[model samples]
Target chain A: MKYKAKVFVTLRPSVLDPAGTAVQSALTQMSYNVESVRIGKYVEMVLDATDESEASDRLHQACDQLLANPVIENYRFELVEAL
Target chain B: MKYKAKVFVTLRPSVLDPAGTAVQSALTQMSYNVESVRIGKYVEMVLDATDESEASDRLHQACDQLLANPVIENYRFELVEAL
Candidate 1:
């Protein structure tokens, strides 16, 4: 079976995001009245697996081992059967 | 009122994503059985607005004007009242 995974990788709240800070400052200068901005990465993938459970497990392992840095990031994923 | 917005910026399907390709190749070499990978940006923001409609409008404007590249990327956002 083929499954599609949508993964979100975000910085832990305690971790500072300098890029986000710079963008926020720029927006504020542009008079956007922005309160806060946090930036992260969104990854989508299609993978072959035996079942939904197996696909989910593989996706989680990918996030933990390859996609996300556990020390400064947190990750989450959603999986669905793909065409 | 404070509103939270989750924005997703992705490359149009017709556009090629080199970074995704590199990652996919690496994953395949690692024996992950990955079919395809797409990479994008996710942005979260908290903003002050008069109502849900206003918040939604502001978020859309942000995506259109600054956050996303309309030439090759598409964007979508979700807005919710913030506690």
Candidate 2:
């Protein structure tokens, strides 16, 4: 079966996101009473696994090993659907 | 008025994404007959602009200036409803 996943990887709260900060500054200057600004990554992957459990496990491993940097970022994955 | 924008910044197809490539390799090892994999950044910005045109123009400027690295990344923005 093929499984589709949406992974969101973001810098941890303690880490500095210069890109996000710069955008926030620009918004302020543009006269926007901004609520909040966050920048993160969205990754979509289509994988072939035996079952949902296996797919989930493998996807988690991928996220830990490559999709995100555990040292400075946190990651989450949503198994969208089976194909 | 306040306007919201969702910016998606992605590496041009030409640039190599080591992180995404690594994940693809891991997925193959996991026996996932992968379809495709792409990784990109999603940014949500709330801006205060006089109108839609101004908001869009400013957002475009922001994307070119800092939200994305034109050299390696391409960015697209969706203007959400006004607030």
Q: Top TM-score: which candidate number?
A: 1
- Give the TM-score of each candidate: 0.97, 0.65
Cα-based lDDT for every prediction: 0.91, 0.80
Best by DockQ: 1
Candidate 1 ranges with C-alpha deviation above 4 Å: none
Residue-level error in angstroms, candidate 2, position B59: 0.9
Encode model 2's per-residue lDDT on A1-83: one tens digit a residue.
Answer: 88898787888888888878876877677655565577989897888777888889888888887778999988888896655
For every candidate, the chain B TM-score is 0.97, 0.89
- Best candidate (score: lDDT): 1
Candidate 2 lDDT tens digits, B1-82: 8888878888898998887777677777776567778788988777777788988888888788777899999988899766
Question: Candidates' DockQ values?
Answer: 0.85, 0.44
